[model samples]
Target: MPQPVIYTHQLTRKFGDFVAVDAITFEVQPGEIFGFLGANGAGKTTAMRILCGLLSPTSGQANVAGFDVYRQNEEIKKQIGYMSQKFSLYENLTVRENIQFFGGIYGLSRQELKDKTNVLIDRLGLHNEANKLVGALPLGWKQKISFSVAILHRPKIVFLDEPTGGVDPITRRQFWDMIYEAAHDGITVFVTTHYMDEAEYCDRVSIMVDGAIAALDTPAGLKKQFNATNMDEVFLQLARGAKRGD
Candidate 1:
């Protein structure tokens, strides 16, 4: 098997006396859709931040896209894409301009930026709205644009923190289609979400209870192991015992 795109061994994080992430270990393969799920403050965000190089781990080891998280954070940033729960696009800029701006940040050359911009606009069926301000577009449009921009650089891994929230069911389904396409193109997707139905779409999922992973397995395996009918039941079975509520 190929080297895992993400590897963590006893990764942990702390805030003063409290342990936000407690020695979690896992691996995510290339083009895999890995779900990181948890309730309010089960340390999911902390663990993800450490993996994304936003926060350093207090102990243990983590390597993302072949770079050490503690020593090569800047390099990790270049090799991965991230989409936060809140939209990260510039509302004031036109759709085309936003794409250009982010693509530029990713170090795309003038011609490369232009080419990518054209391809994205055409692919997303946003030709008519390419020149429109992102603020004026609907939530679904903004979500799609945000996702497109996140992967515009073709990073090895993309971390999505609830990339689909508050949109209609149809829009959510469409958003997932984009995720599937990204994975098919060999982009590893590391996503965190509270949506159980969405969790079922992942290739593998890890559920964090408090500050540790309580379960990690494929959807069907988790269902069989927990004797649950769906992802929702499995999540409830584990998350119900969590000590933290943040």
Candidate 2:
């Protein structure tokens, strides 16, 4: 088995006596599609920001992509990609232009950028649309392109925060296919989502309630343990006990 690419021990983050993350512990193996699920106000986002080196934990230890989140944050930043639910892309830029722009921000050489852009455009079947403005594309296509740009630098791990938040079923299905392809190519995927059905697609899932992980197991395991019919029911059962948003 590959050593865990992401490891967190007693990871906690607090704000003025309010603990967003409370000593959560977990491991994500190389190439695994690990899901972090929770309701609104859950500490999942805090934990992810720490893992991505965008935020520091008040206390505890975390290593992302084999680099310490505190001391080696810059290194961690270079080795990981991030795609938010908003699908950040310049509306005025063409599909290929947005790809080129973000790739340059990651310091890809001109030649490297060109090579990767061509490969991504072909792989995503965006050949005809590559020159069109991104603002004109459908949400599904924009999402696909957003994901492509995020990984253009070939980061070892990609943090996806609600990547499929509002897409249609067919588009969501297509997005997961891209995720599966990324995992197959040995890129670890760390994702957070509210969609229980999407939880079923993960290799393993950790569901957060309040500020700590209340359940961590495979979809089948969680279902069996909770005697629930599906992830929606399992999540519903756990979420009922949450103490937040009161």
lDDT of each: 0.94, 0.92
Candidate 1 residue runs with Cα over 4 Å from true position: none
Model 1 CA lDDT for position 15: 96
Q: Pick by TM-score: which candidate is best?
A: 1
On residues 135-155, what C-alpha lDDT tens digit does candidate 2 reach at each position?
999988898889888888989
Candidate 1: worst 10 consecutive residues by lDDT?
A: 82-91
Tens-digit lDDT string for candidate 1 (65-107)? 9999999999999999999758579999999999999999999
* Model 1 RMSD vs true structure: 0.7
**Looking at candidate 1, what is the lDDT of residue 79?**
96
Cα deviation of 58, candidate 2, in Å: 0.6
